[model samples]
Target: MAATACRRGRLTLPAFLIALALAPVVGGRADTSFDTGPELGQRLLRDVVRIEARDLAEHGFGLVVGVDRDDVYIATARHVVARRAPAGLVEPERASHAIAVSFCALPGAPRQLAAMLDGFDGADDDLALLRAPRPSAYVPELKALAPAGKDGVGDQVWQLGRESDCVVVPTPGVIAGRPDTRHTVRVDLHGALGGASGGPLVSGYGIVGLVKRSDNEVIRAHAIAALAARVRALAGPPFLLGEAGNIPPGDPQAAVADLTETLNGYLFAARDLNTLLRQEIVPRPTFAQMVQRYNGSVNRFKAARDKYDGTLQRNWPAGTLPQWQALRERLWRIHLRFFGLNGQSTTTITGTERAPPPVREQMAALEPELAGLQSDIARFAEHLGKRSIDHAELSQ
Candidate 1:
């Protein structure tokens, strides 16, 4: 059971990472270790702009970090702008909703500048560029772009973000590591907070990356130069940038296959639960009752399992155990209540009132079936257990 719980925990980490990544960017608080230098302070304050967007009744806040001519680009996690425009809001099959950008000299001061929606991509880019109608003379002196470069392990970097009310002054840190395949750069910025997405990462000269989200509150910024290159390649010369292009056909198919495999593993894991109930426990119910209950439980599990499987099939992970365990436990308990053995009860049904001989015969036959279910369940459980152990060992 300890091992099982740990396996469930491992499965939950991805969802946790995603949620942390999407958390609202927080403003910076004071840090004695790193002072916001006079020159950097002016640049950071001027470059960091607040992003306010509306999708129907929903409103969102993010940070705008980069500017090109009249276009000011915001860097936020994809989940921040996940909502799509409702159908019929504009032309048939066209999206009408737009994102808005605003900024003020001071936190509570009246907005000094604003712009209507230009375009955005929630998936590949996770960055949105908004074009202002007219160039605002208030444009901050542009921070130098990070040279086209690859960050090595342990490179020093600094991040600027917002907490609740104040803009986070740049907090300095070193690159902890780079992600396996993604354009993620892990840093050690201390005191980074929520509402910090779209904040800038500065080295010596200019912006190196945009603070997207944190991993365990250790700052993680996306490589701005790399992201811009991808965006430009996919969206074409960045003219009024819009949605990032769909994943190429080949990639989507591979994603589908990966999802199918994961779901198969989960289903394989679930079958073990049913088996454990059937074989290890005793005083099992009449075969008919057993079948009826099993069928009902499995049916419900199938419904939820299928929903999750479909999501996995689409190459996305599903809910954590706490999110889905109630239903899972229901199935587990149904098996235990009927099949689990206790000492022969003092209160007993008289043989005269016993179920029909056919029922008894059927129940007798189920012993083998029960054994089979247990074997399958135990096998899958062992497999999943081994996989979990291996992952833990690797992490260690």
Candidate 2:
């Protein structure tokens, strides 16, 4: 259940994965699109809605936060949904009276969700929290950001945007610095385009900041939970979070490459040791111990995989489920062979040294399975990025 307290002072107002590129251009101009996840229904795009400026007839982005009883709350930049102040002034000229939101419930047919003025903030902060009823299919996870230590220098991040055409595009960037303690995060990237005004800035760990006002040389944003005052006033739970920096979309492949390389390193060592032991270049005890340690490492990975299977259960697809099992079982067999060789005497009662089986063959057999599993991980990551409603009031 969502705690109905302020949780902590929202240090700032704040703010993914690439959603699919099928979004049609709003105008005649050409545009690029994104794909957070298409095979599975995406939740990030579903959570983020396109906000239409009712009277102004303009378009912007809104992040779906949790709901308050009958109404779901959305956090966005005040200027995106407000009437701008007079020239040279900072405050909004007047509050917006009417607004409509669209949800990604059915493919190509966005369901028109709830509408409201619900809340706003002071002149200095470009923050607004609108309350509306939950949508029909895509109830979002109102993920939160770290209230403290949101990020360190050089942390990678994603800038999720909604163009005027309603196409969701995600760009890459980083946390350059924080000049003050007001939780103002200085990002190192180009400012978001006109229609992207209320888009989100995320890191792998969590939501760090809302896409506040920005321009060249002054890429500023409000820290996460900066709108707790407004959120509490409207009856929504403050985000439960920590140091922000949700992983960028590109990282899944990077992680796979890195993890597989580590396994390759281990495989290489095992083969070298086996040859050295057979040739008597290495003593028996040392070879045995090294092989045992390798087995232990493989077992550890299996334990972790077992835990993952237990936790996710039927959520995983049947076809992909056995890839991990196959990988682990292959390694387990290799481990047992090494164990047998380690205990076997070089003399073998016949005064002949034991030779390890050909290693390249094992690697050849393992590589495809390993690569396939890695690909599955990358795809699953894409799915999670879309389905992740970390802060939405989901029933787990």
Candidate 3:
């Protein structure tokens, strides 16, 4: 069903292909009469987040619906947080599991934070709330959409979702019908995909429902109006649109420390890629083993690049330090050589059945760049008086 395809805890080949095909295609805008233009869509993204369970392979999208003076509350599908139990009861695993809530849309905000389960309304409601303390630096001013009163059939609506890559986007649709049982309202959105479940269904009026599941044509969502009280109780007081929580001044030393850590992580991944190019490829290992190792290296490189880019976006120590700027430029050049465009890895081997000659040649070509990057990173670490963080540490 659409639920499995859309709420991706882990990316499968089929889901990745589907996401590749449709993720770039943006849906039409909502009616301009209600001021639901590009500006509003961009603003809504500030409150949306991609949720991941730390203990389990469960991932989905959610909304920061309530931000009190001290904390922020996130709402998502219960299935995203807990596994289903027998006799329609929800599992208690959520209470013990640490969840990661990430704000991908808001720039310069803490990219991810640890959240804990705040409340749940069981299988019937299919709704869950999570709470995380507001950060000491820059809290996102959230505009929580209030539950709309009595949404009728044929009303225009929008469902917000995260693509497999965790880019928040909106799918426009309309309310088709209200199912009498289970407090679900069906939506006629055609673009809902995996990694989109647990997103909000909003209309010109307000938040109409929370996404439950979807088939080919219709999407079933838990009506927010029916459980509005529970939501309020769980999320605490509603979020004010303009409320700016306490934002402390930036700490340059702390930022530099974080930047150094992120750089180390990136360099670590880069060194691994370099080793794969040398030890795995040049040795002419079996095709299967080569493919497997190449795939693993691609994943590591992508993750490292994502983290490095995200951290720099939040706080780039290179902006003020000339030496750091030079190091950053070198890193970017290496990153571009490995990841040419659209974030696709140059050394990726898509199908294991056959390792194309062109791919093999490309892998061979990347060796020099990878080796040079490792050397440059090591020298940069040494220049910063941190010999322990050199490329030699990759051995440990």
Candidate 4:
């Protein structure tokens, strides 16, 4: 029963993997030669628009692909936009909303217009699509829509994206293999870097995949067809017309305010957890030992909490820290678990009891502190629950 209850408090690997699999990819590509000439580059350039977003917490860069009359969609990895700010700055009621995309005509050109993100997915994909009011001047060489097929091992493909310092580059590679339908290609390309995310992977005249990451300089790109199919499924018919339009600028401020609250809530929750561990939970050696067995779970939580607090103080809104009073309530629940204080009220001590008072009294004292910790955690969970995520939105 204890184990089952404890399991409720843990973050399962499968859940984390699902989240990671759904995170958005960011950055641009590096330059290399392609069989297609400069004309192809110019044509593709028209479809590719630089993405820039800002918020109270951070700013980021991304790319927009496929534009039409109604909607001009920007493609990027979902992680770029969905990533939470360091936990320190998060407050109970505030969330860190993403900044708008700053679009420019060309690589070196000044930002021309601002755009906003429309929607995204948080499962099985890491793609996002942003919408702009008007088309930017620069465009990427748009390849024909990919044929209905899957890339095979030894298939030759090409990728185009920007590298560090926003230098657009291309790379050529052969398909290594398909790990899964969602994670399509493992290409053998030269030196992939940080910025070359959300770029195109082409086989023949059609787009085969989107640039995702480079593992030890080996490019790990995702299949375009797979992503497109997911997007079509999620976005329905409207996005297909390329008629996606920008959300009004007035709308984001309120959303940002809400996000700020959510972030603060998460931070407060972390602080609460820290207090509980330090006071009520840590005193119980068995509980401490259990956490320690996980090689630094407790320590990591502490470090992560401290880091988040520092970030919150620097970037978050004032006067939104977690309530100590609420934290006390949560500590009570922790005490119950530590002492096995349920059913017949018999104390089942797991480890040696070396303290002054009877174990029952010690458990009772811990109740309030544990309750306090839970309050903060609950707030953090709430914040996470409210945020919207789309893994497929990150693809281009």
Question: How accurate locally, in lDDT, is each candidate?
Answer: 0.42, 0.49, 0.53, 0.43
Off by over 4 Å in 1: 1-38, 54-73, 83-99, 104-122, 150-152, 164-170, 234-396
Ten-residue stretch with the least lDDT total in model 2: 12-21
- Compared with the true structure, model 4 gives a TM-score of 0.41
Off by over 4 Å in 2: 1-43, 87-92, 104-120, 142-150, 165-170, 179-182, 216-218, 228-230, 233-331, 334-396
Off by over 4 Å in 3: 1-34, 37-39, 86-96, 108-111, 118-120, 137-150, 165-171, 179-181, 234-396
For 1-396, candidate 3 gives per-residue lDDT tens digits of 112221112433222122223123244322111223233444466667778875668888776766767777777887787766666675644432657777746545654554555445555577777777765553553433533433667656676665444442445677888656778888886756556777766654356677877766777888765655566554344634321111111222223344444566666655554445433234223333433433443344333333334333344344434555566667666644444322122224222233345544555777676677667666655554432222211210
**lDDT, candidate 4, 1-396, per-residue tens:** 121334225533221112222223333321211224222333344444444334443333444555566555666655444554455876332222543544433555554444334444532465666555543454433333444533556655655446423333545577777647566578886665555566656554345667666654577766666666655665532333121111111222222233333334434443333343333223444333332222222223322332233323333344333432233234424423442433121122223322223434644565565455545656644543454433222111
- Residue 160 Cα positional deviation in candidate 4, in Å, after optimal superposition: 1.9
Per-residue lDDT value at 23 in model 4: 25
Report model 2's TM-score to 2 decimal places: 0.49
Query: Model 1: per-residue lDDT, tens digit, 110-228?
Result: 44334333444434444554444323555543433543432445545555545433344545577677643667778885665556666666653345576666654587667766666
| Candidate 2: C-alpha RMSD after superposition | 20.0
Model 4 lDDT, full chain set: 0.43
Model with the higher TM-score, candidate 2 or 3: 2
lDDT of 2 by residue, 179-215 (tens): 3566567787665445566666666445567777666
TM-score for each predicted model, relative to the true structure = 0.39, 0.49, 0.45, 0.41
